[model samples]
Target: MDITDNLAAVRRKKLSRRAFNRTLLSAGVGMVATPLIGTRQVVAQETEQGTIFTWGGYDVGELYTSYEAANGALPNFAIFGGTEEALTKMRGGFTPDIAHPCNAGLKRWVDTGMFQPIDTSRLSNWGDVIPELVAMDGNDAGDGQPWLAPFDWGGTSITYRTDLFELEEEESWDMLWDKRYAGQLGSLASGGDAWWCGAIKAGVPFGEIATDEAFEKISAAMREQRPLIRVYTDDTTTLEQALSSGEMAAAMTWNSSAVALASEGIPVRFARPKEGALTWVCGLMVHKDAPNLDKAYEIIDSLLSVEAGKFMINDYGYGHSNAKSFDQFDAQTLVGLGLSKDPGDILSAGHFMIPQSQEWETRMNETFEMIKAGF
Candidate 1:
């Protein structure tokens, strides 16, 4: 599909709720969506705050309020559909001042030699950031400097409509595999998420995911699912639209989708699969040759602020790295959002994606894409 006009429109500004998901589909990214309460309004201005290469939804004015207060305008942004795509561009010499990639690919990203260790001392809000998130696997860049500044944390699980979808049993990842919902189930296109979810369904442990035997098992499991899925897309808009209209009974989605839908009075459940949910922490990394190094730090500081945390938690339904972000909401409210004051409480209960080699990443993505293509 020639979505150049669509892509250009979405890239020009932050998106509204109605337009957000469709823009996501156009951008070739999936799962992430707009806040249920409102869309972020960004006043476009000349770039004074550097550039942040992130997913489509994070470019809002609210997350950058502190940075904008310090500088005159928000940073220039370049959006990508997924982390893999973001990394591929940067590796090809398209460096942004800051890039957002999650923890699972930390080692491969660090090994790429295009990034520099973030000196935590530059960030004023560093002290208030959650310790565990900061200490995630492969984050520490040797002499105590970290590779990425911890940002949002959340889970990936099935989000299904309670009213329309008949729950044959308590929610399970199997809802996506059920023959009953064949041709009505949606899935993420990126192997970064879906492949890992496949491992879980195939009963392969994260530690053994790279093994030859494990690969065959997961491939078979995915191929079994291929015939059943109506669409394989990363666009949250497409998945959420089908789900909201009752065209799809269930789908594999991030926590953000369910949060947005439930807030709008949609009868949905972000499943608590007996098999653990996939958990992750995505954060910021500075390019080695960041033109706006100081502004990059400023961007990190702004996102780490309690105010940013409040917006991320209250609106997007993701856990924030700033512990103080949880202070604004009462315990019950956080619980209702499927979050906790302590992120560890949630993270520990779920399956964290283990870091993998570049070779493994390439193979997994290739295999999953092949399966999606009916190979």
Candidate 2:
């Protein structure tokens, strides 16, 4: 089935008691039988390996190896393109101990019963994580339990070639829709973030706008700019190639990818325009029926530990929600990651990716598809 079809199926299943009861029963059995249940009968703290699903560059395998060396086991990792794709996989029965999805996408995952409640009490560093990251209904399991551990976040900003576009002369969201750059612009290919850029360019609020009219407006805007699109891609490597070769003179991009392309001497520059950005925060959440829950928390603890956050900040140029990571990394490192000693500036400017109602999401996807088809 197509994504729309799959989404419909998920909605139907969520409303079906047979499916819900089966899931509940499975979770109950898994909780009781697995080593994760802290009951006296189950070995809650046993050493074991777990599987993790995440986006590329988020999991530096060496970190897992180090955790394994210290803790007697490691997590097997898998990478995904986006949250929608990850959720689609879960619905199709692709199981992993943990899946990394952004905060905005959590409601769908939680509503579908894809994840288990987190044992926040067992996590050594749970309290150290920024409270704002977990400040959501899905942070806890459907059963009033904590479901996920928060991770690094970043923004969807305008990444233009400074050498290609004069910065002092050109600094606006207009760079993306500029007719002058016809056949030389790029954007995210995935539906959610792609439409997010379209909405922002069309003057729609990133977090609000719950109507079909808003979707149509954004879709029309994207359609108008469609001819100018050089490529619609999810791969940063492809975007870097486009930027370097001038296949794309300018584009909407994630901050880390822009920084990486820029640092390569490709003359790229990132900007948060007056219209703001489509930002997102990703975190690790375990499946309720995961085969290995203890190992999952171990993976979470290791990844969210101050050391891992520092590594992510320094190596990847992505911002971490861990407030203490700044103390662990130097000023130069923090600057590279776009983190300030004072984080309030970051919070003030950043937009959280929010989960709109599924009905709106469906309409948004349909509108985007129509625009892309016409293109």
Candidate 3:
């Protein structure tokens, strides 16, 4: 059958909490919604289709298409420039059914109490996630409810024009603040991740350097590099465009974007750096008052599927949290995706973004503003 015909067949399947398993695996509607190994009770009802909010390059179109093929309806998607932008929209009452944010930022999200616990029992493929990802830190509600379900996980490494900058001698975070490349550097405008970059460059401990004094030093370091930065861009496409034209020689960037650009023959390379790149892990979270809990979980389940994980690694150049997904990849594919066949090696040089209190976030933002204004 054609794509349209398969979708229609999916719609006829009737999504039910209990009947999820009896379905066949034809045309993407093959998800098994059985109860946990020793659990009881039907999972949950499949609510209405949802609108998912996430950063660009996080969730790809294949996920949505696959969901539609399986469930007969597609979730609406809204992409944002950064976690802050998504939060700002949420603050402005632009509620989406699902939101994607990094683990470091989940506390602020949980503080709002606008999220609900993930029903792992309903997630048929939760077992597929790597133990490291599931065990990754997250902000829990005061009552002890976990707020996020992880999807794609990666790092924020320096992406430099290899053809322009030699990686040997300058294979460190100092390249971000090099006077020789002043006014040509690039970084995200968001203070959350950018401040960590600045802090690391100033030789501050990733978790211990949140004081005003340390922030001031970080601010000064950023200010000193102002002459080298041409753009404070958070948009990957725009950054890539600028890099393609040589408008930027180097920048603190998401590792996946750097890999994707290199794939397109942009001659860019991601670095581990002397201080180690600031790593970030993000995941899907259901809204506290989400209108479509069951449907949202279905989407989450689809995301956690090995098939979906394979597509994510191959197409998006991201390292998936699904442990089994890596087994499908060969040596070359692993190298191309900037991953190691061994999980430990992949995480050796990476560091998780430090979760901070709200007060600290405010201080970092204030300091970043001063730095941006040439203070």
Candidate 4:
């Protein structure tokens, strides 16, 4: 079944509250909905209390154990589906104390002048975070203070059903476009990943993605590949379910999907393509006009804590910013999950998505949507 049908099935199942929460959080579905235009009142009221605008699952109690223990209550939470949506809401005057965005979006977020620099000294666990992560592109300002605190890092590549697809030679991104698996293939819905993967197949370097020729090449490649896709979705749960049920031979996905599927004894593999995986790091940033600055710092530090790091790695199958989190798993286990002992190595091995201008991002997203609509 396609993702739409799978979701219909889930709704019909009438899952228990716990199971339903997991589905919503795991899918990163936004908890609150509002149109892009017009203004709305901020949800939380107390100045001493803070609200976190982040992806769904990050708001769970386990992640904020430290903060909750100290404050005697969990902070207010609002969720966003993606960085662009969160940025749009912020620009529309939604003032959440903290917002989560990936490294690729750091420059764009900073350019908006909506966030403030985090005081690293305030975080007790700051010394233990991977230095390279803290120093990633767009993390630092010219004055030397950092704005984003790196939280979760992972790779983007093909996650395929091992039983249905065989790699005769080196695993390559070309597998997604192989005519033999045309009707069985799937890919991410967003241009952020799909477009870059197309650029890789077109032999366009990450650095040249902004050029007119590179844009044409990437667009053509995607248009050619679109008809092959059985479904396009950001919901990894749907992709995992389809792959497990033998409905899809392959799909472009992150490390977490492969990990989830393999744990369930599904015949799955996260491919290390010849062109390399796309790597990214996402983190938290404080709002420039944050009402509860102290509480925001607590939330950031708690997320970077060793306890939270453990949850991030084991539960979510992502690499944590804290170096000590690697100690939780053995070398072989880490290898099986396609993670290195040092996340810096993973970042170096793949093309870390660079920041693009707002204009470029807008155009690319619109073009990708047109292609997906069979234009």
TM-scores, all models, native as reference: 0.87, 0.81, 0.81, 0.86
Best by TM-score: 1
Candidate 4 deviant stretches above 4 angstroms: 1-49
Model 2 error, position 316 (Å): 1.6
Stretches off by above 4 angstroms in model 3 are 1-48, 139-145, 168-170
Local distance difference test scores for all models: 0.87, 0.73, 0.73, 0.85
Residue-level lDDT of model 3, residues 84-159, one tens digit each, is 6677788888777788877778777777667788877778877766666656555443353356777887677788
Query: Which 10 residues in a row give candidate 1 its minimum summed lDDT?
Result: 36-45
Which ranges in model 2 have alpha carbons more than 4 Å from their true place?
A: 1-48, 71-73, 137-145, 167-170, 330-336
Best by lDDT: 1
lDDT of 1 by residue, 29-115 (tens): 433444422334332232445889998789998999889998878888899998678788987888688988888888888889989
Candidate 4, 196-218: lDDT as tens digits:
78888899988888999988998
Q: Per-residue lDDT tens digits of candidate 2, residues 17-76?
A: 565576679679987787644554333332246878888876666446446866665566
Error of 4 at 371 (Å): 1.2
**Residue 31 deviation, candidate 2, in Å?**
39
The backbone clash count of each candidate, in order, is: 2, 5, 7, 0
Q: In model 3, what is the error at residue 285, expressed in angstroms?
A: 1.1
